[model samples]
Target chain A: MGRIRLTLCVDDSHADDLGDIAGAARRAGMTVEQELSGIGVLTGSIDADNLDALRAIAGVTSVEQERDVTLPPPGSPVQ
Target chain B: MARKSRKRPAKKQAALETLSVSPPEQPQAGGSAPATAPGTTGRFLVLFDRSAAPQAPNTLRRVANLSLASAADFEDGIVEPEGLGGADAVMLPDLAIAIASAPPEQTHALGVASDTGILAIEPERVVYTSGQGWPLNTGPAASADDMAPLDYLRGYRDAVNEVYDRLTGQHDAEAELGAEAVTAFDEADATWGLQATRVVSSQHSGRGIRVAVLDTGVDSGHPDFAGRAVTGASFVQGESVQDGHGHGTHCIGTACGPERPGILPRYGVAHEADIFAGKVLSNRGSGTDGGILAGIQWGVSNKCAIISMSLGAPVQVGQSFSQVYEHAARRALMQGSLIIAAAGNDSRRPARVAPVSHPANCPSVMAVAAIDERFAVARFSNGGLNPQGGQVDIAGPGVDVRSSWPRPTLYNTISGTSMATPHVAGIAALYAQADSTFRGRVLMSMLTQYARRLRAPARDVGAGLVQAL
Candidate 1:
């Protein structure tokens, strides 16, 4: 499986333990990129095959894939 | 005045009979006031037990009366008189509650109300509205009859000449948007959304508030903003703050343009607001997550009251929300800044209702939908039912909307939730200006409460069209 960027939502109660919780991703061969401390979310890339194991980790609420965003192109039927 | 011993009407009785009362939840923290601040003579809304009789309405009112008789705000001060009269109490049987004036001594009030099987007590919200011709300004003076007729004509000529000279000088600095538009602009009322929201009549111009527009930068040199207070920075590497794409300029114009443009119709709202243009997207209207996140951090750190982003990428159906952006938005809100983003124009309405886009799909960010002049959902405006996170929060004028643009094309007509998002942002600025107490969640509540309820479904126009003042 290929590496994929993902966003993880951690339970707010366990937000203070993000450093320890992030070890789970490292064990699963994921590279944690950004730690959004305010909202209790972390963004990183992980092997697609390890996604299931990542979800089972404690304190992890949700895992969503990071995707690209863009503006509405010119003459792209905005109306 | 005595309490009127009126019977519960059949309709009200039926509603109260089915309403259930849940246990009290933890009150919101972070400087949020208690549900009922003690000793204040403000109204309190008390919830009753679901299985309680329809007559429980009176029971809740009585609880408030007893609680008010011993409130703390005035306990050791004045000996005020009071009666929980008919006019002082209002019952909403459908919601199984009654709102009555009281001194909000929570310990006493909650204990009394709970005895009557009450669920919770909340302060009656104060609805804010920008009254007609609010922030009133002096109108044009009339000519005196005693003055010579020629003098009156001269006076009028001088006034017109002065205004004309100023307008020409401004417009000449930049190319005219269009000759036809110039003729129509002066005669035009506020853009449809502004008119619908009553922003045109509002006197609160978002003065002293900083509004950050994070998008494809803005034309800082635009004539409409010749003397306006604007600050900007570019997050996109190798790019300047100048807007090559017109999207940022148009969005900025709608959210914080001048009250009266040199030659165009009044298209802007929040006219006096300070503009903070953050270039998150590249000139090509594209940017990565890092750039946008940086922009968000910048806006919040500067203590902006409102952050408007008329940009986003599509989110697939059934896709989960971006936790990263959600946290960023929550942090912004906690810091007293509101982030409003476009709900995405990916829908092919009457065919497919696409989900709201990323960043906007996050709960903390207010997602704005697009409505046309007819008040119908625009063909491209996304709908609710994403099943996870993306949902429309409010609607704004989007179709065939005219606003400022990049140079050489000083104006343009476009449509999308992008156009609508700025409308909400601008109205938010007005709300922020009208009341110093309004910020973060309270500001959001004021917007929804004062919104003009539209005929569309909640999925189409969450709380309906956002109102001004």
Candidate 2:
């Protein structure tokens, strides 16, 4: 599995909402690896494949996946 | 959706069976308790880290790195080639192999050798084990035929333990542990006696602890649990409060079964524990990790003390899936909820697949294994950390164990430590209750440290048998 990146952008007014939003995002499936201290950039993988759902959270303005994910099928032979 | 009402919160009751305060109306035949026979403990191939010293092909090793073969506290490992005839613990191979060439006598021998544990073998050879003589037609579930007599015997033994507990009255300390139970404990029979008695009930009965049982809903009305279950919901779309699969019902009943019958602990280890019964798994017992993770979050938000996940996250051993229970567990624990998950019951004969999957292995969660009535590890209890690291934690009764279900069926017998987890959760709750000051992690530590080491040690039987308060 490759490390797929998730990028979330929020409006300045709702900027303080990032922590709670990040917490919810973490629950929804994104891992917060590196945070952009000032401007507010959250990067993590969408392991649960619910990046779109993460975008639906109240404060999330926009969400983007920075890399392609190679998800394996069920019961495939172990490599 | 809605939780069902089952029993009272009183400590003298069984989830189903009533207490015989007076002589029982039926006066069932008083049979002598079953004798605990010495099981076959032998030698199997236990792999050693051999970091500084490379070893031979077939040798037994201790569970801990610093634990040498001479140490009594060390968990023993077994080797297979010489036959597990005299072995107490067998080393598990990374995978499970179906040994077709294994003689029937050998199977019977292995079955009889309670001390002799089964080590898992690799999968390729499982299908490759010469098909001439073995009866691997069905998995362990089908092997029920091979173990039916023993299963019945397990029921017999459990009944005997119940009877013995009754005659002694000096059983479960967790029973009716009211105000006096806290400060004025009777010190004589203080040792946690096995059986439904709450030796460690209040001390561990998850009191005030809210656990989100992501299985079948609770019996909203069981008196044993008056107001015990605060909230309930479902995910199977149309499934109501009814425990259609019976598995979830049995699970919740045990996880938080009221203590009136005197068998299970009565007070809330998590007695006042709130539950969010999310039925992600249908009546047949299956679900998506998405639903489970959602339930995990719900429990976390409600600030559940722990999340009892009596389900398995699938596996091919090395196979990795997006549904990693680790991350969810991490988040849950981060949010103040400890996750207790079941090790899968899929491994069968030779080298099969490793039974543990994502969730249990996730950090800080307790991954429990099933132990049988004999107190030897359940033949199917999944392994961990082999030579001693895999996926097991402490073990509880998972064979022929009777617990609550929905209205009609009332009670049923379930196997698998999935049936075993709530026992640990229950024990944890009890430990929490005994002294409210106890930290969840500390409580877990005390329980594990004091776990009665079983004779039949295996990766599956981690930390041996779990004890009551």
Candidate 3:
């Protein structure tokens, strides 16, 4: 099992960076999917070549693994 | 005006039944003299057993110009001071109040007061008379139209205006959420919690986000929804696309109700967006995947920027079709539609119950859990610690929240991730509206980053609880 990072876009200029990230991921032997611009949902294998490539890309403001999504604990009733 | 024993019944019984948590601290000087300062006449008359008073903090407190009376101070959340004892004999009587519906205990008291014809209820609402029929006696309720005396015109004006002021300060709740929903402090944000209904009036009110309320139909005639363009269709036969169950109304209300407290710049989200209501279930709240599928198709085709699904289908355990659902969610994402789904209410199990529901279990969509102000997951919100790690995207306010309902009225509150789902959808809309270039990755990323996570952290909480920008 492997982990993929997610990034998002705030403007159109971020579009090209999306392609770059996907290309880097492709080179690294991993899958890169674009939900939109800086926000790309990554999954599958981590390609060695793409690892250093995408991280170096500009405008990649933030990155987090998909599985780390925060969830609330159970039964917080607010009456 | 002796206590007319023959005029009505329950007066004496009701008076004797009046109980207080504790004796008024002042013990004297009652008469609307303020709860803290106390007047000679209105000292509390404890009717219940002396030890029966609740030991919580006393209701006696003198704030800056007014003494606040906690709603909790009353037995039924209402205080009827004059009726606590013989209307004439009660000392320093300030105001006597009772619900217009007259709960059994209150009914007896009013019935007795009616003997002296002292009971004067407003035409359609509650009216508190001083002792008997004298409306102007308390000075707060006396209508200006009643010509009693000229010398006290200012007092009468102040009293009636007090009532009138309350009625006039309607706050112009833009989305027709009514007076109950005053623009309040968004305790979550630590600022005024922007009115939920005000989401309707804005430049990009969900224009990019296509929200599908997958529940009962919605009230098209709602004032917040009035004049706004929306497409209507129903899976329920003969159910003319109106909010019958009221669930959808609330979900949609929170996502994007209407706008107020703005132009002056108040806190609100998602001003540009259009809603596509998916009436998958019948008005009675039951439906199969067929209607749901149709609703989803509608959302997909209409190019909704975001689709909010608050309902769930009970799928059996061990049965899995994760691939197919994931594929559809993937397709929705590719189509530029951000799908925000409720994590589902299955608090009984910490693990995602199976056979998991469709749509929500889909990988491409963002699954949301419900949380309270303290950032705890709601009892009903489904939890997950993903085989991958955190499964939920982020949490939103799913607690007791007021939102839209089907008419004769427009807004109220109900709890469920169903209520929570649209809140995320609205924020997504806000993101998309603010920046059209915002696609799935950017949108979800922003949401996850800004979300306030809970103790369950990676397990019960998803990306974390969502915090407003």
Candidate 4:
């Protein structure tokens, strides 16, 4: 709808470039929240429309929306 | 607060039908075994600059000269950082390098060292075990006279004998099965076969290993774990550490149940493994992604070896995996915690097979499929519909699985990929105990490598049925 939290995965080679990553996120109209160095991942908030542009950034491996994960309850039929 | 035992109201008794293990007629005993000490080696696995190690041998020697004895043990731990801080540490040799510290401290040190070429620094993380603050909810308590030193000795002897049974696979298999067990050749006693005889018999109990089960809460009152240690936390907003729902108790029972089950059909796997119950899902058996991720992070930060999640929401036939969960799983693996999740139970009999669910579909998370006693893939288990990662990674006994339930109902038999996921988690714990090297991705590889491949399609069963030892 408006803005949603997105997890942006970075290529191993470009993982340490915080300035470049921040610039790319800003250009894509996203605000970076956290940078996970050990696994080369960045968490940020971005509009749904800018998702495609964020994915196209250099060294960006993938950009996926963070969504709620709910477990199937007991007695729910599999079929 | 003093933990109180729970009693099922008398009105609910008529509705309870699940078979329960009658209390053993054996003598009452309460001897406590001395707690085993934790491992010492993985405390500080600091990675330094290998290229620089040779060129700047003097720097290495100077750093090794620190008073701490542990620093000298890592003589060969070094690697080159691809980026950041390489120039800083290399240019300023006078700056102190922290080899081992807590996570927050190590992160600061790594940030500084990365720019100077120190490569990487890994701090030892704390892993929590269960059976701590939360006491049994509704189980019997022995008086001081009943817990005499002689009784405690008898209990110790009994524990040793049970360990011997686990090693030799010697037990009253037929009598334990009771009257309800399928007698003909059509079915093997799941209690003896699926997790017990075939898996646990080959290895010692998963003692000293830290296992985290992220699911609906567990029955803190289950009598089967009278003196067992279980540390638990609830991520569900309004719930406490107690398992209001029975699913978590059932799953935990299979993964870390006692070898000498007070009831019939000893269905547990890694009996002695330290159980860390993280209640990600609520008593209603449902939860959001944030809670689940928080639970995963808790397990990783604690350095739990195996995190079993018998939970998942269905996905479309060709949806991409969640990058966030995938990254969480990857990071957990790096921290030596392997996560095993349930594939969706959405398949249609004789017609369609649903895709694996969200987090489970992630490449980094192991997706477990459900199988019945006949060694056939359960009709409801999801199939690998996506060409890439949304596929079943392994199979486990799920159909009509009998395990512990919330008191005073005591036990129940339910079927789903949920039941199957714990089997893999329990077996993973056994593998971890059998070989010290089995942890993280290596443990995962060993599980599928040793699995007993079935006749089902690869998409349905991944590598095959998970094996122990």
Best by lDDT: 1
lDDT per model vs. reference: 0.73, 0.51, 0.50, 0.68
Model 4 agreement with the true structure over B99-214: per-residue lDDT tens digits: 33111222233334333346654433333244332222222543222334455466598668757876788844322211122333322333833542276455578888888999
Q: What is the CAPRI rating of model 3's predicted complex? A: incorrect
Candidate 1 lDDT over residue span B1-469, tens digit each: 3443233233322322232222113354542333322222345666777776375644644653332222223345332335343254545555666555533342234444445777776544433253532222122332121134455466599557657867777433111100111112223656666777788889899999899999999998889989999999998889999998888999999999888886657888999999999998888888877667778877888889899988888878888777768876877898899999888888886668899887788888898998876677887888776855578888898888888988777888888899999999998999999888899888888888888776566787889889887
Which ranges in model 2 have alpha carbons more than 4 Å from their true place?
Answer: A1-79, B1-204, B221-227, B261-272, B319-324, B349-353, B385-389
What's the lDDT for residue B310 in model 2? 79
> What is the lDDT for B108 in model 3?
33
**Sliding window of 10 residues with minimal summed lDDT for model 3 chain B:** B56-65
lDDT score at residue A42, model 4, on the 0-100 scale: 69
Q: Across residues A17-78, which tens digit of lDDT does each residue of candidate 1 receive? A: 88877888788777987665545666778889999988988998778776556776655547
How much DockQ does model 1 earn? 0.28
- Best to worst by TM-score, what's the order? 1, 4, 2, 3
Residue A31, model 3: Cα distance from true site in angstroms = 38
Cα lDDT tens digits for candidate 3, B1-469: 2222222223422432342212234333323332211122323221212232231112111100112243345565554644433322221122332222112233234333322223332212223354444233334433343334443576577557557756888322211111122234353431122333233333455555556666667777776676666677786667777767677776777776665421122222454457677776666666654355456556776777777787664434433424423544565677677678876666543333322244465667787777654455666666553332125667776767666667665545456677678778877787777677776656778778866544444444577656444
Model 2 TM-score on a 0 to 1 scale: 0.49
Error of 2 at B28 (Å): 61
TM-scores of the models, in the order given: 0.62, 0.49, 0.47, 0.59
